[model samples]
Target: MTDRAFRNLDNLRASASTARVLNLLRVSHEHGRTDGWRAAPLFENSTLNRCLVIKHRLRRNEIDAFRVRRYVATKIILPIDGSDLRVGGRYIFVDQVGFDAMLEQALGIGPSHPDRKILALIDELPSLDPFLLREQLRRNGHAPDPCYFNVSEADLMRMSDFVASEITPLVDLSIGPDADLAAENPVARLTAKIMSNSAGEDMSALGQTLMLRPEEYEEGVFCWKGFLYYKWALQTITGDIGWVVDSVRRVKPRGRVDTEQHVAIDRAKEQVRRRILITCEATADMLRVYDDAFRGLTREGRPTAFRDFLRDAPILFARLGERLGAIQHIVSFWKYRMTGDRSAPGAEELLDLLADFETSLSGRERPDVLALAA
Candidate 1:
């Protein structure tokens, strides 16, 4: 293989999006040998191998789009079908208005409603260790790790159906069984078909995996899907709160409340916080870089690249909102505590939630540290 081939393979393996999408394909397809799919030359004085690589990149981008939808569903504590998410060029709309209305109905229906329980579990997700939850689900032989919290198997199946149905349109256009790759040039058509067929096979396999075999390789896939979500969350949290940390570091607390023990505890928390945030930020940045490459692969007439960007755009927005929300909550809480400022809505409620969340998991856990770094 040439140096270019080696570079392409190196880049492929290093990509989080590629790894997850490829693994999902691997799990779904019982047939077909993809032994050195990454290492093989993408182009060798010919168009054949280049087409293969292009198809692989396309598959990975499509999966990354779904990852964004999953994160939005999990983050908002609502059941979202694919129809709920729409992607246009550089724009995404999640039906928050409908989602909120549904949530209100669920709330009015009381805690006994099934949606109420699901929403509650999702709300509690930020407070719990995903590793622990995943392990628990694996031990219990559940379908999806995210459904480990008291959700019924039937409900899990329903969620799967909803997701499958919602994503059908994108899949049909992108990689469904009916998809074809053709061009006016004969050689181009042949090579494109080869890659397109492979991609279609993978998509069919994924449909089976999502609906029928979610438990197969559940742990790895579960962690991989959350890659973007955790990355954005941790980075934004650390970045937004850097000022607070700097203040603590620069000004030594004096007097009754600033004892030696208090100072040590505060420093320990900062150290742990820094370690977590730094690891998350690095990996998140790497994914973003790969995503940029994925976005550059489209032709002039087809705006699929921009659509892919739209799919993941909501994730970035959501992360920024989370960070700003935290900062706003903190500021308002302090203001209220010191001088009775009631202008910031939900500040007191958010502070309570944060306190509860912080108490549930320690930032210094080795598994969490390793997971974030991974």
Candidate 2:
């Protein structure tokens, strides 16, 4: 062979271990063989060794590279199916027989059992140990001898020929059947539908809502979605008060009415509290709502609005505490009422609930006041 022909042959030979070579051979014989020969010209033992070295280096330096590389090596086995063949524990087995069969079929050599011979070829590789392969290649003629040299050229030619004839036809026949089966599979259909839907043009309402420049609405939606997802994932887990507070903090008042919304929320809370005092029923539940509404208002830093309203309604806070017998919520109202020259009849009851509410709301009690109360 001329230098060019030898180079071309070398390129083709490198790919002998690749599925691409088998796939090419399976396609159009004339075109594929010519392309393989073209590829052969680019091959060199030095280049191949360098590739192997780089692969080894990447395997050592990168996480999961060794595992993935090993997996890729396993995929090189067989009818070009590109499936992983892992045997449990000590060692991984490569389907050398299947590889040889593909080569034989590619070269138009013999029939089925030739694949078994390919497996034998893997066994006969220069050295199973990668280190040994590197060292041997370095010692003798620089580069591991081509695998084809381990077996006769005539045998390889026969194997390649068999692959070209029989295996290619079989693969062609199976592709149609496999495609049909894949199309019929419910999971496959669902996957395709999902993929198609994902690719389809669709405008997001959330995106539109965000574009409206309402930061509070955007934040509320995010908080709602996050809470919904959390609740969905863990039903037993209660809502996150911190997240709710954070969401409320993001609410930017759009107009005076938005400020009034805070007032409305507080008014609703006071109304609920008033109804509880008047009716003397479900005070705890009403107080819980009132506390939540206060928290939400405080999250928006509008507690002063409620405080001003409370200043006007001193009798409400005083009477509520006296009727409820110094409950924490009632005492909290009394504590606020007494905070600035506004003493009520339940001022003494303020000590415990004031400390408790301060602890609950601010996550810390006023140490001096709490100590004095104790």
Best by lDDT: 1
- What are the clash counts of all predictions, listed in order? 2, 29
Total backbone clashes of model 2?
29
lDDT of 1 by residue, 199-225 (tens): 233333433433423333232233322
Give the C-alpha lDDT of model 1. Answer: 0.31
Q: Hey, what RMSD does candidate 1 come out at?
A: 21.5
Using alpha carbons, what is the TM-score of model 2?
Answer: 0.13
The worst-scoring run of ten residues by lDDT in candidate 2 lies at 49-58
Listed in order, each prediction's TM-score against the native is 0.28, 0.13
> Cα miss at 65, model 1 (Å)?
45
RMSD of each: 21.5, 33.9
TM-score of 1: 0.28
